[model samples]
Target: MFNWNLIGSIILPNIGGWAGAITTAGQMKNENGTAWYQTLEKPSWNPPNWLFGPAWTVLYCGMGFASYLVWRDCGGFTKKSILPLVLYGGQLVLNWTWTPVFFRLHQIGLALIHIFLLDAAAAACTASFIAVNKNTAYFMVPYLAWLCFATTLNYSIWQLNKDDGENYK
Candidate 1:
């Protein structure tokens, strides 16, 4: 008989990741700060505001499923499995942190720092996932690529808004 428990086990973690992304994304200021983002000196090829949600939704789902695969392939919460999970969680935490610091507090500089760390964590997580499960590792590759782009964008905003010092204070 097919292991229904195994199937559900793999599915649940991805669902949890999606749920968390949705719950936390609720804190973003996409509509509230459209003017603020528009005023910034974004790249020539920067995507329209409407693109971010869809892109991130897909990426987060990939990360979530990758996470589940990594866990399952590594025999679930064992020593080998733990590292990837930790890295996954670390990247997710950093991902979740960026929105609040940038949109809510208006701390672009701090948000840039957060994004940089997030990029590093994501790369490491991808590496670990690849070591454990090729399919899972493949899934996170796009997310890592996007974060690399995002880090550059974050740096750009910090550079353009260098004069934002103490303005919100």
Candidate 2:
């Protein structure tokens, strides 16, 4: 059996993440590694711009796969499935919102808040996924780790730029 629903489950979250990236590409292109970001006071440890695309691609794939496992184990849309799915969806929305908040709106402080909430949501989603399947839960670990690192980066950016008064505000 092809299991089209299972296929959809595996594909949709990745697609959503990809689409979100595409939709925000213009802002990212404008802000990333450009004079604006370069002018900002950032930590020396901040990742090079080249790393983000590949890292996000892997993370998005993991998200989709993890969601698929939860969907498969819980047999879709039932009471057992709702919590994990909801948590997954919630974190996805938060994930999608971060780029725009940071890049487009140029709100580093708000972006830091969003990323922290995103980290919390992702952690909760992972825990819920564990109740359904351990492998699925494991799949989210790297994403969670990345979010933790990203949160630190975001916080550092906000702190470093807080006195810039003219740029961020």
For every candidate in turn, the CA RMSD to the true structure comes to: 4.0, 2.5
In candidate 2, position 4 carries an lDDT of 81
Query: Would you give me the overall lDDT of model 2?
Result: 0.82
Clash count, one per candidate: 0, 0
Model 2, span 42-74: residue lDDT tens:
899999877887798788878888898888888
Runs in model 2 with CA error above 4 Å? Answer: 1-3, 28-35
lDDT (10s digit) by residue, model 1, range 1-169: 9766456544544454455455445443466754455556666777766677678767776777788788778888899888888988887877876776776566788888789888889889899999988887567889888888888877877777687664221
What TM-score do all the candidates reach, one by one? 0.77, 0.87
Q: Which ten residues in a row have the lowest lDDT in candidate 1?
A: 20-29
RMSD after Cα superposition, model 2: 2.5
State the local distance difference test value for candidate 1: 0.73
